[model samples]
Target: MNTESPVSRRAALCGIVVALAVPSGLVTACGSPAPSGTGSGSTPKQNGSTPTSASSGGALVALADVPEGGGAVVDGPGGKKIVVARISATEVKAYDATCTHQGSTVAEPSGGTITCQSHGSQFSPADGSVKKGPATTGLRAVAVRVQGDQVVLA
Candidate 1:
C-alpha cells in the first residue's frame, strides 16, 4: 500500500525543475540591455518652456559644497550653466542652469525646488519637473555622476 513512492517523487522533482526553468528563461529574456549606450529612463524629448540646448559642460563640482537636500548653480561652457543638487548621500541631480520659462537662470534651490527669479517659475530639483505656473514644462535634466570626491557632469 505504502510501497509506491519512487516514481511519484521523481515526477514531482521533474515538475518543479520545469517550473523553475520556464520562469528563469522568461526573466533572462526580459532583463537585457539595449544596443545603444543609454538604457532605460531615456531623457524626455518634449521641451518645457525653455529651449533645449547643449549643456555648457561646466566644471566638476564638489559634492560637499552642495548641501544635502539643497543645490548650487554654476556657469558652464558656451555661456551655459548647470544646477547641482545633492538629493542624498548617494544621489545627485543636475539640470540646465537656464530657466525654462524665459531663458533666465534658475535661482537657488528652495525646499527641494528651484524657482526662476525672472518670472517666478518653480521646478523640481529632484528630477527637473515643472511645479508651478508660467512654466508648464519641466526643467531639462542634465546627466551627472560622482567620481571620487568630485561630481562630474556626464
Candidate 2:
C-alpha cells in the first residue's frame, strides 16, 4: 500500500535533519559570548577617543568613546551585548542590545534611535521605549555610570 519513492523518502529525512540542525546552530551562536577584549575590552583610544580609567562592570568602552549624539555597542555583564549612548555631554544611557523582536543583537544607536537590523525595529535611547513596530516592547535597561573616565555599572 506504500507508494513513496526511495529518493522522496531520503529527501524528506534530509529536510527534517536540516530543519533541526539549523535551529540548534542558531541558538548556540546567539547565546555564545563575543571574543574577549573585542566586545567589552575596547578602550577609548581603541574607539578613536581619549583614554579613561578602567573600572568595574568589566570596563566597557570609555565615556569618551561613545559619540556625543550617537552610541556604541559593547559587551556588558555576563558578556551580553549593551548599547551605550551619550544623550549629551553629561548624560548617558545604557540598554540591552538584544532586539525585542526576535533576539537579534541590535545595531548601534544613531540619530538618537536604536535600530534592529533583522526586523527594522527602533527604540529610544533615552528611556528604552519602543519607537517602531515589529518590536512592541522596549529594550531592557542596564545600570551604568562614568567613573574616572570609564563607563561602569552603577
| lDDT (0 to 1) per candidate | 0.71, 0.76
Candidate 2 achieves a global lDDT of: 0.76
> TM-scores, in order shown?
0.62, 0.63
Any runs in candidate 2 off by more than 4 Å, and if so which? 1-57
Clashing pairs in model 1, backbone N/Cα/C closer than 3 A: none
lDDT (Cα, tens digit) per residue for candidate 2, span 1-154: 8796566775666566656764444333434544565434643332122223333466677988999889899987667888998888878878878888899999988997999999899999887888897998788777677777887876
* Stretches of model 1 off by over 4 angstroms after superposition: 1-59
Which 10-residue window in model 1 sums to the lowest lDDT? Answer: 46-55
RMSD of each: 16.9, 11.1
lDDT per residue, candidate 1, 44-141, as tens digits? 55333232344444345887878888988876555567788888997887788777667988976869889988898998877788889698778777
TM-score of decoy 1: 0.62
